[model samples]
Structure formats: C-alpha cells, structure tokens
Target chain A: MRVGIVVFPGSNCDRDCARAVAEVSGRPAAWIWHKDRDLGGADLVIVPGGFSYGDYLRCGAIARFSPVMEEVVAFARRGGPVIGICNGFQILTEAGLLPGALMRNVGLKFICQDVHLSVGDTGSPLLGGYRPGQVVRMPVAHADGRFHADAETLSRIEGEGRVAFRYCDAEGRVGGPSNPNGSLAAIAGIVSPGGNVLGMMPHPERAAEAILGGTDGRALFVAALSRAA
Target chain B: MKARVYVTLRQGVLDPQGRAVLHALSSLGFDQVRDARIGKYVELEIADGPRDEAEKAVREMARRLLANPVIEDFRVEIPGEGEAR
Candidate 1:
C-alpha cells in the first residue's frame, strides 16, 4: 500500500511519519509538498504534525490554503483514507474537511507529555486496530489543542459515533484531569461522517516505535494499510 | 484604504488568556477588575475603492481568514469612512 505524507513549510514531523508508515507497512511513503496539486496515487494520505505557517494567524490557518490541501480535500471527498495529526488536525478543521475547531488549551500552556487515550469508536480504519474502550498511550505536544464545537454539533458527533478517542486515566475512565488539554468531552480524536477522514491532536507517529517507548500507535498505520489492501 | 478588525471569542466561550490576565490583575491589587477578555486586533491595508465594496471585501476576509466563526466574532472598522462598525 502506498502512503502519502503531506509536508507544509513548517512541518517538522513528515520524516517521522514517513518512517512510521514504512516501518508498519514495509512500504516507503512518498512526500507530497504543500505546493503540489496531486497525491501521487497514494492509497492513504497523512498530514503530519508540525507548526505549519509558524502557527501564524492561527495554527494551521495559513496552511489550509496550501495547494496540496485542495487535492487532499478531493481525495477525502472520494472516501480515501486520510489521517491528520496535531497541526494537521487543525488544518483539516480549518479547511472544513472536519467539523469543529481546536482552540488554545484551557491552561494556556504548551503541553508536552504522554497521555492515555480511550478508544471510543472501532468502526473506522484508523482505529480498527483497537477495541472500543481500550486504553492506549500516545504523546501530545501542542499549545492549542482544545477541541471546540457547538453543543448541537458535539451531540451530533457523539450520537453518530464519529468520536474515535477520548482522553482517559490509566484505568480508562474519562473526564476531570485525565483530559490533558481540556478538550470538549475529553475528545482526543474524531472521524468524519464518511469514516475516511480522521483528525487527532496526539502524535501517533511518535509512539509507533518500540524504541520510542511504545508501539501501540503502529497498529493504526497497519490497520490503514490492511483496509486499503 | 485601511481597515482594522477585532476578533473576540464569542460569549460563553472560555478564554484562558483572558482568565490569566484577570488573575494577574487581581494579584496586582486591581481587585475592582471584574473580568478580562483578550482578543486579536488586525490591521489591513488594501487598495482604495468604493466604501461599500471595501467593507464587503474586508467582511469576507474576516469571515474567511481573520476569525473562526465557530468560537469567535469579528468586527471590521474603516477609519474615517463613516463608521462601518
């Protein structure tokens, strides 16, 4: 399976994401520059994490207008597997590919640490590796990661089973300080209505290597490739 | 022409920065300060044009880029142009 990693000007995690995809699926991923208009026939497209556009104006706000995003949007519209990590998630929301916006953390601090996440949805390819209610650990690094949406939208997303992950304690209980960024309902990840697009604040690639501490994140890439094949 | 835009979080949306500022003020003996809300102030310079058209363009910009309608509200002002508040 071919994986495409989109790179924006300030994206710092493209190489890492590519390595994770290659390691998990044994296929070297291709790099798609922000200026490029095509996805290079990728079966899966990944928007890697980084401070795109230097986080100017707003996180991912400027990167949403990148030429490559036009093709990414089209690919997602065609029900292609698309995953956005961290700032990439912000970009997807900013581009209207996903619902809601990621606002600044409730503490106004740049949070960087490993967090426990409870899988909430198992129907999507991105999260199919884990069973619902399972807890996994992934590192998150961002200042603006609190997800915000209207009450109606939040209710609809939850009711539709679009929520893919929620912050939780080691015991798998969600809420309170278990929420690292104070995201609404402790949401850490979500999938689109079509289940082809996913945006999450945590850096799954960072946790995909055993050398990096844990390999739970590798299963996500494996599941994506498995579904694509 | 030039335009100034003010982007503020919508009512009921939590503003962590604003809360921090309020706490700082309270610590500085400014107990009278009941609240604080921090927002963005952007200034733009564009080609001089019809007042109506200019307002329309800037409004579009605010909606599309300057502010995220999900949690923030934006106001555009054209200085000395009969107040397009």
Candidate 2:
C-alpha cells in the first residue's frame, strides 16, 4: 500500500510520519508539499503533526487555506482514508472535514509529553485494529488541543459513533491527568461521518517504534495499509 | 475604499491568551477587570471603488473565509475614501 504524507509550511513531522508508515507497512510513502495538489498515487493521506504556519493567526489557521487541502478534502469525500494528527487535526477541523474545535488547555499551557489514550471504537478504518477501551501511550504536543463543541453537537457526534478515541488512564478509565488536556468529554480523536476522515490531537507517529517508547501507534498505520490492501 | 475585518472568538469559546491577559491584569492589581476577550483586526487594502459594493465584498469575505463561524465572529468596516469623508 502506498501512503502520502501532506507537508505544510511549518510541519515538522512529515519525515517521522513517513517513517512510521514505511516501518509498519513497508510502504514507500511520498511527501507531498503544500503547493502540490496531487496525492502522488497513494491510497492513504496522512496529515502529520507540527505547528503549521507557526501556529500563527490560530493553530492551523493559515494552513487551512493552503492549496493542497482542497485536494485532500476532495479525496476524503471520495471515501479515501485520511488521518490528521495534532496540528494536522486542527487543519482538518478548520477545513470543515471534521467536527468541533480544539481550544486551549484549561490551564492555558502547551502540553508536550507521553499520555495515555483510550481507543473508543474499532469500526473506523483509522482505528479498526485496536479494541475499545484500550489504552495506548503516545506523545501529545499542542496548546490548543482541548476539544469543544456544543452539547447538542457533542451528542450528535457520540450518537453517530464519530467519537473514535478518548483520553484515559493506563487502566482505561477516562478523566483528568489521564485525559491530560481537559478535553471535552476527555476526547482525543474523532472520525468524520463517512469514517474515512479522522482528526486526532495526539502524535501517533511519535510512538511508532519500540525504541521511541512503544509500538502501539504503529498498528494504526498497519491497519490503514491493511484496509487499503 | 479600504475595508477592515475584526475577527473574534465567540462567547463560551475558551480564549487562553485572553485568560493569560486577565491573569496578568489581576496580578497588576486590576481587580475590577472581570474578563477580557481577545480579537484581531485585519486591514484590507482594497482599491477605491463604489463604497457600498466594496463593503459588501469585504463582508462576504469576513463570513466565508476570514473567520470560522463555529467559534469566531467577524465584522466588516469601510474606511473613509479619498477626501470623501
């Protein structure tokens, strides 16, 4: 399976994401720059983590208007799988691919560290390889990762099974410290209506190898390849 | 005529920068300041033309692109043109 990693102006995780994809799936992924509109014949597009546009204007604010995102949106609408991590997730939300907005941490600090995440569902192509209520260790870096949506919208997302991952403790219980960012409902990630698009605030690519810490995030790329195959 | 767009986060949306500003103000002994909301002002240098028409276009830009409707609000203002007051 081929993977495409979209590279925005300030994105620093494209190489790492490509490495993760290559490591787990053995796929020769291509790095598509913001000026490039094509997906480079890849079946999956991963918008990797980083402070795009220097997180100026707002996190992922300037990058949303980047030319490549238009093509990414079209590809996603066609049932193609797309995964956005960290600031990439914010770009997706700004591009209207995902629901809700990621606000600042309650403490108003930029959080960066390994945190436990709870896999909420297995039906999504993005997280199908994991089990529900499973906790995985991954690094999260962002000032605006607190997810917020109105109560009605929140209910709709949950009801539609669009809530893909929630922050949790090592024991798989959801709440503060475990949930780290004080995200609404302790959410970490979410999937779109069609399930082909996902926006997650955590950096799964950072945990793709055992040497880094754990390989729990590696299976996600593997699952994408599995489904693409 | 030139137009300006003001973009601001909506109420109930958390503004960390604004919170920090509030904290700093409180620390400086400004206890009467109950809250502070952050916002941005963008000046668009559009060529002088029909005043009403230019303002309309800037308003559309404000709604459609300048600000996110879900979390932010935007308003357009037209500056006085070439000695027209």
Choose the strongest candidate by TM-score.
1
Q: Residue A100's C-alpha lDDT in candidate 2?
A: 88
DockQ of 1: 0.82
Docking class for model 2 is medium
Among all windows of ten consecutive residues in candidate 1 chain A, which has the lowest summed lDDT? Answer: A120-129
Model 1 fnat value:
0.78
lDDT of each residue in A1-229, candidate 2, tens digit only: 6788999878999999988878887666888888887888778999988888898777877898888888999999999999999988999998889988888887878899888888876379778778877888888988889998878889989988888888887888888678777788998999999899989998888899989887888878878888877
**Per-prediction TM-score:** 0.97, 0.94
Where does candidate 2 stray beyond 4 Å? Answer: B81-85
Instruction: Quantify all predictions' global Cα lDDT against the true fold.
Output: 0.91, 0.86
Sliding window of 10 residues with minimal summed lDDT for model 2 chain B: B76-85
